[model samples]
Target: MRRSSVATSFLLVSALGLTACSGGGSDGDDGARKAAEGLATALAAAAAPADGASTPSDPLAAVTWTGTDPATVAKEYAAVIDGMDGIAPSVEVAEVDGEADKPTATLTWTWPVVAGGDPWTYDTTVALADGDGWAVAWAPSIVEPSLADGETLDATTLLAERGEITGAGGEKLVTERPVVRIGIDRTKVTAAAAPASARALAELVDIEGAPFVKAVKAAGDKAFVEAITYRANDVPAAVRTGIDGIAGARQVTGEQALAPTRDFAAPILGRVGPVTAEMVEKDPDAYRPGDVAGVSGLQARYDEQLRGTTGRSVHAVPADGGEERELFLAEPAAGKPLALTLDRRLQTLAERVLGGVTPASALVAIRPSDGSILAAANGSGTGGQNYATFGQFAPGSTFKSVTSLALLRAGLTPQTQVQCTPTVTVNGKRFKNYSDYPSSAIGTIPLEEAIAQSCNTALIGARAKVKDGDLADAAASLGLGIDHDLGFPAYFGEVPPPASETEGAADLIGQGKVLASPMAMATVIASVQAGTTVVPHLVDGVDVSVPSEAEPLSAAEARQLKAMLRRVVTNGSGRGLADLPGGPVIAKTGTAEYADGGTIRTHAWMIAAQGDLAVAVFVQTGESGSRTAGPLLEEFLRAAR
Candidate 1:
């Protein structure tokens, strides 16, 4: 039986004086054995820490140990509790060998030299003698075999340096940035003044006032109630001086381990925040309550890779006072960088193009050759949402490129004569072209001219030449709606089959159930520009490699579409790009209409190709696709070149 049972039985025998319970021996020895066994069990539990807390497993708490020194035992127990807060040890005591008056037994225990490492086991002896009843003889040596005069347990942490997040060209996008936590030092200010100080800081920093006041007021005296964290370079000198004038207001600067720009590719790169209780509970081995880790985005997606192993060390110090001796330990390792495909220059350019636009816009650029994403930028209007790669919006006329592919598959060449009507009704649903539809090219125009003009009714009229699945399949052929791992979250645009003729007509024009992200549409333009469906990627050095299901556009289809798109830039609505310094720019312009709050709003979209880059840019509400988004597109391509 386990030693604890023997000690437990000892308590019962001594308490009941069960002389008749034993066959040949007196219950005295049995009681002594049980006491020793119980002591060993309790010691083991106390030594092995669980989730950062100490628990005593010895069965000796119930019975009073008669000969035990209460004060000595209490101090000794307290020392053991403090020392064993973070270790796992096993202890076992053999049955008593001495007589009842001065019973003694051998005890053995094994302690791990380091958590999850080799162990150190040793044997010692303890005594159980008569008192008010049988009880343990407590001593420091009972706790550990190496115990001498006086020693206590001690621990110290060894932190490992975190890794860096690198961008394309291997520049550090996120490194060890200097930061400051500004808040009220409650102790320096009166309770009545804390609220005013907190409110002043909140307004200066533009954070909510009530929460700041509540947090400051609730904090104990001498507590530093942090209101906000900011990078040292970004905080204004004027604001710092203003806070200095307020008593108890202060800024504590330190090295914050995270990215530099708060909004720079946040949705893709991710953010770092305080380690939550859930994080500590879920990963006790990796995270602690006060640690900072990736809370969301790519940081959260690849947290472990970025947060390397941690090291620890435990020591034995003299309880009376002396230098600590190393007992157990491990070394921490620094994390490695996560390579990316984003070009810092192009990403900065994309952001600059959408800088002043207030209506949730995005600009995405991808390489046609390998589908490597060059830039994914979201405007301030998005309020931190990753609209570049996940925003679901109709491509408007931008999707006509997909419809064009479907048409070309049906033996309809760019020169195939198709009517560019003012309005075309399908199954009682009416679709109209833009109000400025050129009159001379209205009736019986070649498909090439129709596409160049972004003639909605032209494509709606030609919708009869294809089935609903053709539009979806064509989009899929260009990498839309196809599922593959990118090691992060994304929506590759969805072009589901139309349920009715009205839906089909709308689908033909890149509207009516046709949903896509800016990144998604960029891929569509890229496929045509590159001749094969392009799979966009972000994380470099990841296993996102997948086989392509899309066949490159046939030579005839490629030749014809290229000519048609080029005409759109030269002779059609996209004539805005005629002066682009990048010279020959091929493109398509789209103005998709949607109902918001019962009012019609249009998304001006422009997808284009200049040399090796395929780009997609959008504006939530605009006058026209070419006129509204065209200037931005031209600026980007010219600057890119």
Candidate 2:
């Protein structure tokens, strides 16, 4: 019984295992058949047209469409297949209703034409596909290829905040714009007989008769042109009537007009002109025609700061046969005003002081503490001729100050004994003093007395004791033989360093080869008065500033120099200045002989401090310093104070 039971259990287990395996196989077959049927149905549906039509009117009825050229589409498809190397599944076209006329029937996409924050409208044409979406048809226009690299369109007019040019006490010296100008449009008087038009324009505008007729004829060729000349200060009341008389004439404000001052400081202030081609070629971005620029003095120096940046705009115009449009526009820029360090009172004083003297005389005054050029006035020569900085003459006895300083630095004192002989011989040359007086009458004199007396012999005798290089170095330290770098052109006054020992001896007496400008001589006296070496400045503080590192002289030396200079006014050559009412004056005088062998014609000079101001005057082809230049300095000093 146990064996029979074991046999039945084994048969039952085998039967159950076989039955389970067969059932598993049948379920796998069913699932495979269902999946195959679903795929076949999808393929058939994709290939067939809508509504069960046998064939469609369009060749691309069963496939999604895009606007791209057929060649590009083919290339993209080939590229995708090559990229995948046949490992990816193949793509099939899908069909939809009205696919023939619709390029992207099943696809939808959002295309952005104009970029963000753009105010103008843009035209964008996009292509669509079945499921891939859309792309831009063309790229943004790169229209500036013909222009030079980095070049762009810029506005012609510029607007800027002007600075004020004021006097020393902060009073306004330069005024701002206060009026507007109205111009007539001369081009539109197109009547067959324009006599009435011209007469009407003359009535309304400032121009008249022949000029008005000429302007109208010239402007007729231009579309919109301004009259050659317009009314300044105010618009004429008749302009409205004149414009009404003409068919299409108009009255408007012109962009260019005169500033209100009417050339108050004309030559000094300079004028503006159109930019030239040479300037543009040198710097492509620097300037354009019809732009105003500084032509002289302070104007030229501070042009960059005075002139400012320009602005821009747009005016739209309709494009031909299209929805797109064109734009045309511009914005103007204004200029900045300049503030000067000039004292108007002092300038007027200088002009008056220079008037009585011949046109050859020149004068310059400056403040010592800061090297601020207070006044500069020049007598006439020619156009743009300013002798104050440009004239070169023998400095004469004024150079004695430099010679004395050299002697002092070389261990000589005011009491140093120096014989004042009529003539002294050095290196085979005989150099005579200014006068032919005997040495007995002017024996050994004190250095201070020699300077006060304007004794040429004493100065040359004293200079003999010092080396040539020392005198040159001393004179240079006092601002000789070097350009002061003032805004305008200045001659450094030729004091060629002595080439030989013989030339050196001649230089000592203010003879042979010593030259200086009136401006430079004034600077020397100012240095002595201020007790420090200073460069004379012009154009206010724009050209130069006081050197932060300059060291001043000792108080004792300053006091001694001041005392010696004072004696020159009270008891010596400059006694003409002694009678002035205000206060004590200190001065020096010079009468330099010309190289042309005439009588002492050009008087070179120095007028030291009178109260707070110092003045130096030079008169070419004039009398002695005392007679010719001293009186002018005295007159100026009294007026200046």
| Top TM-score model | 1
- Estimate, for each residue in 1-641, the C-alpha lDDT of model 1 and write its tens digit: 01122433343334322211221234566666665665665555444434233333332353245456445565675575364435445666655664644567788766543333354556777866565455666776776655655676555446556678887789888788898878899878999999999998888888899977987887667578877778887787767888988878898997766664677787788887666668878876566543567888888778888866656576777867677777667676777778778888899889988998988888999988887888999999988889888889988998888888899988799889998888888888888988787888889999999999889888888777897477777787777877667876778888887788898889889898999988988988887787776788888865644336555567777777778888998889889887877557789999899889999989999999978899999888887788888888888998998
TM-scores for all candidates: the values are 0.81, 0.60
The global C-alpha lDDT for each of the candidates, from Candidate 1 onward, is 0.75, 0.53
Which one is best on lDDT? 1
Once fitted onto the true fold, the runs of candidate 1 whose alpha carbons sit more than 4 angstroms away are 1-36, 44-60, 63-134, 137-154, 181-228, 235-253, 281-286, 316-325, 543-551
Model 2, span 361-385: residue lDDT tens:
6777777666565766676531345
The pairs that clash in candidate 1 are 3-37, 6-34, 7-34, 7-35, 10-31, 42-57, 42-58
